[model samples]
Target: AEVAPGAVHVPDWLDLETRRRLVAACREWATPRAGFRAARLPNGGVMSVRTVCLGWHWYPYKYSKTIDDVDGAPVTPFPGWLAELGQRAVSDAYGAAVEYQPDIALINHYDSAAKMGLHQDKDEASLEPVVSLSLGDACVFRFGNTEHRGRPWTDVELRSGDLFVFGGPSRLAFHGVTKTLPDHGDPDLDLSGRLNITLRVSGF
Candidate 1:
């Protein structure tokens, strides 16, 4: 469904096997090197959600080749298959093949107590559609306008295996996850928390 002019939400986008593979991939990415860690803001506040970045390490307001906040480890390389996945996701959301090179993928984990604040993904130079894939627990996703983080926003319930893509007019829109439903993850997945993967192009 088109939630906004350029935002589309597709529920049950991933099947059981695909979700399992994705969960396994996430687990591997969270293990070594610049593994999953909380991002610290310039305001001396650490984000609630822990994140593991690929292709390019993302900091407070910019992208980097290394995890500057961490031990300065070189960030993991972005997988070509993942970029292809993003392309497929964008294409599926728009109901047409879209050219997109998501150079960076942000994998965020939100536990029962975790929640994201209203924010805009304006750090990237590219204005390509942002592809978001959800797994595990369900959450309330608020997609706002590009103007500000205030009202006039639409809230959508995002469940496991869901896909949401925003671009064009809504590429820079403010969005966030208000809260997550605990004990809602598929028991067979062996995952106890929610996972959100957002694909963005660096245009670099």
Candidate 2:
């Protein structure tokens, strides 16, 4: 998602060792501590079950069939190395020697068929840039204009180890994952589907 300086891609910010460790940790933490269940949407539909990790297990706005609170999941605290990586991303993008350390690392898991619709990240009080890292299979990222929902969208291919940052004017832009291309992942990564780690400043 392009906010001010347009969509800029950060290449391979995560080293092999760090990425491996992070992925391993996530795998161990995948269990739904809050009891995974389908979530009911405002439209009365349901979304897939998501296991969230806040400081503790407390994800989903409510457990029905579909959960509308995609942002309700626990903000996975970024690992020290990951936090350092995020700090660099912020400094490079904003270019003001900012010390924007992330408090919440929202980890999103997408199976083979699961998909994400266009939506904005409006739960946080801060409008700081969001740093998202993609791992596993490749996925199509649809970034739309901040003012409107559809049209004038830019679809970018997010591959393993790819980094995306969105802030400033395009911070509130509508974006979503169209789909994940199966079997397009790095074998060395050992991840099957799509795992997205988005680092953000939650509380202002």
Report how far off residue 104 is in candidate 2 (Å): 1.1
Using alpha carbons, what is the TM-score of model 2?
Answer: 0.80
Off by over 4 Å in 2: 1-6, 32-39, 48-51, 55-81, 94-96
Q: Evaluated with lDDT, which candidate comes out highest?
A: 1
lDDT of 1 by residue, 142-204 (tens): 998889889999999899999989988999899999999997777658788899999999987
User: Residue by residue across 13-65, what tens digits does model 2's lDDT show?
Assistant: 56777678868877765555433334456678765524434332223332222
lDDT of each: 0.90, 0.69
Task: Return the lDDT, model 1, position 119.
Answer: 96
The C-alpha RMSD of each candidate to the native structure, in angstroms, is 1.0, 4.5
Model 1 poorest 10 in a row by lDDT: 183-192
